[model samples]
Target: MTSTPPDDFDAVVGAAPSAVTTPTLEHTAEHAAEPRGSRFDDWWARTVYTPARQRLWYWGAPLAVTLLAAVLRLWNLGNPHVLVFDETFYVKDSYTLMHLGYEASWPADADTKFNAGDTDIFTSAPSFVAHPPFGKWMISLGLAVFGAGNSVGWRISTAIVGILAVVLVMLIARRLFRSTLVATIAGLLMAVDGHAIVMSRVALLDGSVMFLALLAFGCLLLDRGWFQRRLDAKVARRRLAGGPADWGPTLWWRPWLLTAAVLLGLCSGVKWSGLYFLAFFAVYVVVVDAVARRRAGIPFWISASILKQGPATFLLMVPLALVTYIATWTGWLVTSGGYYRHWAQTDGQPWAGALNWVPLWFQNLWHYQTAMYGYSINLHVPHPYQANPLTWLFMIRPTSMYYAGSSLGQNGCASANCSSAITSIGNPLIWWAAAACAFYLVYRLARYREWKVGLILMGLAAGYLPWLLYTGRTVFQFYTIAFEPYLILGLAFVISLIIGTRTDAAWRRKRGLLVTAIFLAFVLAISVFFYPLWTGQQVPFWYWQLHIWLPSWR
Candidate 1:
């Protein structure tokens, strides 16, 4: 498989220029080049490489795809007219949060009563929810504008972020792969993928986590380019002045890092699992900085990066993330009705007085954190739809979020028997093929040491590897939605490899394009076939059964 040269930024309009030149980049570009696709290359050069046109594609393509994604996720979004799966928990919590400034409990049969149009469902007492309130607050934003009792309100936020995630992945792929074509394909693939669509159409935390994490990732990518430009400028200045440079430049005004920290903080606000991405990206960014310095001929690059830039990045990211996380609890802290809000006052602990400097609500927040941690860790009850993480990539089993069986003359069933279901399943062609393509990514990382490959792999790992630690706990295939963009990126990266460069032979390039088109066509076909399952549309039972290629999908 072919990998794009790191320093081939010249071929990519609007890419950063680094002062450091390496023999590896020159060699790889030369070796990967073929000499037969002048016509295709000419079109790309004339159309996409023009500065103004490039800008249009950059801004226009993502918005177009986002519109497509929005339409797919929002059509009949209020259907089934009921809270599906975990929406029963989060939608109600969001309703109470908007009204009471915190989540409130409900009656024992709240689901039944609430679905039946009993809008006044919640009790005045606070609920002890394990997750943070920010995601629910996001839901509340939609509920506040669109009425709390409406299904569109329950799901509008996820749908919006879901569309935003499609755009974010496009920008990120553009940065990583340095090809507008690659970015457009990656975004379109994500726009059509059933997994992304399902999570977007539902009221769920994972979709928000996916969008926030991808936003942070895009910020880091921007930071890399911005830092590289600064580094190049500094290196050029030192060389022109003929001064003895001990280490390198110290870049302190890193707005991108802080932006990433803020987004990551929001990610963690949605789910604690986002902390993994925050930690992973912090290490990844610093390492890239060290590598850049070393390649720029700095003798003490490691120490310089660690002592100067490392601390700067840490200060910009970690503390901001911490403060942002604390700020997400403002609703709970300000309200007297929140669960455990008075724990410090009532626990009668010896350290309560010793810790009098801290506010009472802050003290209770700490205690609540401990209790939430325990509750999350101890949740090991078996679930029928729980899938092993090992099977996630293959999509051997996917959870059915909603299902209704009807006989003839029921609910517009035109057949003898029919079923309407909302299944959290991905397009088989995309998910299953991505599993195969990811192996190519591993190979590229090992053989080429492509930094972008490593970054994409880190995303996949951060979103996926943590689940391995909880193998005994109930986990679902839907959790993969958080990292689904990376898989699409991996697939796009592989397809780019197949398509090779503009220099590749005409026949080889055309053949590769054909293969890619055929594969995408297969994916689109599968998605169409499974669309009924994704959106809870009624289909003949045999047609629904036909979509279940594997018995586990049942």
Candidate 2:
């Protein structure tokens, strides 16, 4: 991607024109022709895409880099030889769903047999699992091939999706910031980050949620770019060639946004939390569209954006999500013998025969859903490691997913001291800085009305802040997986800021980037250094203790 320096004074490059370009309006006039993607086409489209004129590397390099991430995440994979965290739930459930057509309960120690490649004891009954079946269905895809014997069966799908997510984030960051360097950095950070790594290795519903939600987010960004391009092209055709171009650009059936909605619904199908992000982003898309329309100077932009954009987002997300969500319950629908297979028939509700001959089991499933919703909202249990969302940014507490007893000699500990632990502690270097960045984002959002700040805040709010509303819940630190991607992105955004301001002197800016790069290198080194502890690698006690930066970490 060879190109010239994009100086603030180089005409049509800065919000604040260079002192040199000030006395002469020559520079601004020339860049006005540059369009979205770079400094060449309709240059005045600063608020939108800038057409790229210089040499640029394609997606090949990003793909290769993503493969490297996959190697790290998927290698070994089945160590500790046990379900690390919620794998206990998702892995076993997925196996039953595949074998029995519904999630059925297993013995208390079923993980031991399942780990040892023995699933013969699992029954052929519909299990009363809480979550929707999509995530389990995915897990079962791997188990069906790998046979639920080891972590490979449970984890391979998630690990693959996790690495693919890195690729998606890179592609997304590349488009959003218009910087290959930023995109690579985001991918590189995700490659080794603790939360992404740990979650990938465990067969957890949250990781699936993370993958689908992030996928949807990525798709919407692309959809935004595609929509704007069509809008501009349509407007140009009308103004230049003379036609009404009435309906404000045909962006009716946005495929990517629809993909996002299906993914979002599936995400909620995995867990109810996806509903919040779906609701938020649906509105977010419409608002972004309206603003883009207004800026483009369409005569009836307001009505057009609402009428055209709003309904499509609704159609894509709400109904599509509902359908996908319902489909996840088909296993319950078809089954005659379930946990609550006859509640409506026995209790004899008015709508008991509403879908007459639909089977009493199906009616009981609906009743179970009503009861489940009640339980989820009214949950008020307190917990020991229950962290406040307020403290999430600080990495003050991390969940220990596994710990076992063994002598130092038995587990290869150097001085008769043995310790085996899989903790969900985040990279301190990245997280501590992100907390400061969060405050900075808050200030910038209020001052400049920057959309970047708002996006980060919204993600964090949906992931972290909402927990404030449920301070009474018995949540654990491992729940951070829900929002860890945004946290990582927040850190990456701050690092971009550290890479020097466009307003800084050229030499100073270069130096700032150098320092930032070195800082990121250290963070990467730390991730690799602690990889042993993050996964259940057998390391000496003293070696493990060295990684414990605080007493709480120990």
Candidate 3:
């Protein structure tokens, strides 16, 4: 203390070193203002070892992964020399509609002749068919482009759309999970699934339904994001102004929602059952909006959404869908001989306009819908392959699309006892694991509030559970395409848990990643093993026999 007292004799320095002091309070504010990590904060650094190279993981890897998926799906698309499954119905309907301008009745015993490459059996005049022509419309496009090319023509549409679906899976999974790895995983899984591939190679409505449902689902996801962002910006503005945010924030009219509506209309145009997804998703969008409002701390959010947002959403979705559905009937409306085409001209009519050319026929369509409803709801026929929702996971008694035995030396015969057939079986590893994953999801929904668990549950519910209630109706597991995208989502969710969301403790994270890699490898391997059956390849009878793990599979 004595040594520090000099400063220009009185002030050599403004203050002696011993007298100088720093304040302990300076760091108080820094400590208070520092950001404490939420559980996700340490995710990337802890789990993703490549820190400076994060961009490569998202963009570059997905492109590479998608290529792998494409090769698996697109190669050897033509195998079965004959139409597989219901390719007979949709493919032939497409041709009949194209040639006749409407569905024409077939001569008795037409299939034997038609399958013989003789197209002369379809008769003139309208044939009363149950389903609308839009699905056939799409099938016709494929045939027109790729006609009678055998496997090429019959399966072209499904193959192309299946490829497109892989692209969609990448986009949806990337957006939902925000991880490129998760998206690539989803795409790869979809690409390798035996059911999806078999369905793709055959002309069927379920693949188209899958496409439309996936499109609408993607749109709803986009709309939810847009709505939430609009809320956030409004909240930020209010906070900056030092005032509580107003409850009514202006929302942009969402075209994606409209796109979703129109796609659903097209879906309904294909099959009336598509309306179920439209109804469920329409209500789902409103609930999502309400939640977004509540999370933004908007008081009276329920009424705010119900009164202001709900009507606009409905107008944009349901009624617009109704209008589009009616538009799908334009061809029928123009034709007088359509099955119910005379409703307006019938002697006693409830709604009048026949003389105006718009006709009571339009009104009669309402009555026709009632009849269609009865047929769908009251259908209770038992069949060998009529599997219940409880057993769908196992892929037992899978639907056989086509079966014929060729004597040795005829077409595909590697054995003295020749066998040639096509069976629409699922990839056992992927589906079985999905079942286990879904079982886990069901458990977690009761115990933990996981977003993936709940969202995936909706799709499975809409597609599978509804069928359970309608078990009295003729239903099949092949219809599961309605929910395949979400099933993939559920699988991706489990993958996410295994990978620990790009962040986790060292041991847990390592184990999770190992499991994901192992599962993916196993799934791809299974796809290769089943590629013969999926594509109708002419493997030896014994080679085909290798895939029939169960006696029921026969």
lDDT of 3 at 489: 80
lDDT by residue (425-510, candidate 2, tens digit) is 77777667666777777776787666665676677667676677766666666667777767666666666665544444455556
Query: What overall lDDT goes with each candidate model?
Result: 0.83, 0.70, 0.71
Consecutive 10-residue window with the lowest summed lDDT within model 3? 7-16
Model 3, span 1-554: residue lDDT tens:
02111111101111111444664776757655654423433564454445435555555666776676566566766665465667767777777777766677777766666656676577766666667678777777777886654556666777777777777877877766666667778888888888887777778888887887788888887877788888778877888888866565646478889999998998888887678888888878777878888888888788878887788888889988898887777667676556556654574366535545544766666656666677667767787776666667777777777666655777757576555555778888888778777877888787765554666676667666666676555677788777777888878877776666322345565676678779888888888888777765665677777888988887
Q: Candidate 1: lDDT of 40?
A: 57
* Candidate No. with top lDDT: 1
TM-score of each: 0.90, 0.83, 0.83
Q: Which structure is stronger by TM-score: 1 or 2?
A: 1
Full-model lDDT, candidate 3: 0.71
- Candidates 2 and 3 compared: the better one by lDDT is 3
